[model samples]
Target: MVDARGLSCPMPVLMTQKAMKSKEDYYEVLVDNKTPCENVTRFAESQGYKVAVEEKNGEYLLKISK
Candidate 1:
């Protein structure tokens, strides 16, 4: 699991990419903003991972399943 809140754009996705590279199972990424969440989701999709996103309490929760 990775919490990317308070991080700027691309950083969150970069971190997420790293996390995914180190894991062979599912991963969860938490971001405070929407743009990062969208970018991460798109990246996950492009990598052949299943992506799920939910917005709650002004935060975004992104789940990636390989």
Candidate 2:
């Protein structure tokens, strides 16, 4: 899981990229705002992962899986 809460923009995307480098089948990215959530989801999907999003308490949890 990549905890990207309190982080912004490229930071969240960068963390997700690093985690993806591990070649894991699935990953979860957490972010507090819409921009990071959208950015991370886009990055994951562009990499061919299926992206699922859950919103709770104004935060977003993105589940990315092959």
Candidate 3:
């Protein structure tokens, strides 16, 4: 799991992409802002990956599974 909260813009997606490069099953990302979440989801979707977005309190949870 990658906790990307407080990160801005493409960083979350970029970091997640890097983290998932070595992953073969599932990954989870946590972002405080919606834009980063959206960007991450977009990046994941572009790669033909499945992502689930959920809100817990004020934070966003993005889970990508292969």
Candidate 4:
């Protein structure tokens, strides 16, 4: 899992992208705000992964898979 919580915009997306380089079929990204969540989701989707977001408390958990 890429823990992007407490991080800002491009950082979350960058972290997610770095994790994706592992060539895994599935990845999980945790972000504290909606902007990072949406940004990461878009990045993952653009890379051909399907993104599913879940909200817990005030954070977002993004499940990205091919």
For residues 1-66, what per-residue lDDT tens digits would candidate 2 score against the true structure?
Answer: 999999989999999999999999999999999999999988999999999999999999998999
All models, RMSD in angstroms? 0.9, 0.5, 1.0, 0.5
Q: What is the lDDT of residue 34 in candidate 1?
A: 82
Enumerate clash totals for all models, in the order shown.
0, 0, 0, 0
Best by lDDT: 2
Worst 10 residues of 3 by lDDT: 19-28
Looking at model 1, how many pairs of residues clash?
0
Give the alpha carbon lDDT tens digit for every residue of 1-66 in model 3. 889999998899899889878956788999999899999999988877899999988899998886
Misplaced by over 4 Å in model 1 are none
Pairs that collide in candidate 3 are none
TM-scores of the candidates are: 0.92, 0.97, 0.91, 0.97
Off-target runs (Cα >4 Å) in candidate 2 are none
Report the poorest 10 consecutive residues by lDDT, candidate 1. 16-25
In order, candidate lDDTs are: 0.89, 0.95, 0.89, 0.92
> What's the candidate order when arranged by decreasing TM-score?
2, 4, 1, 3
Tens-place lDDT per residue, model 4, 1-66, is: 999999998999988888888899999999999899889989999999999999999999898999
- TM-score top scorer: 2
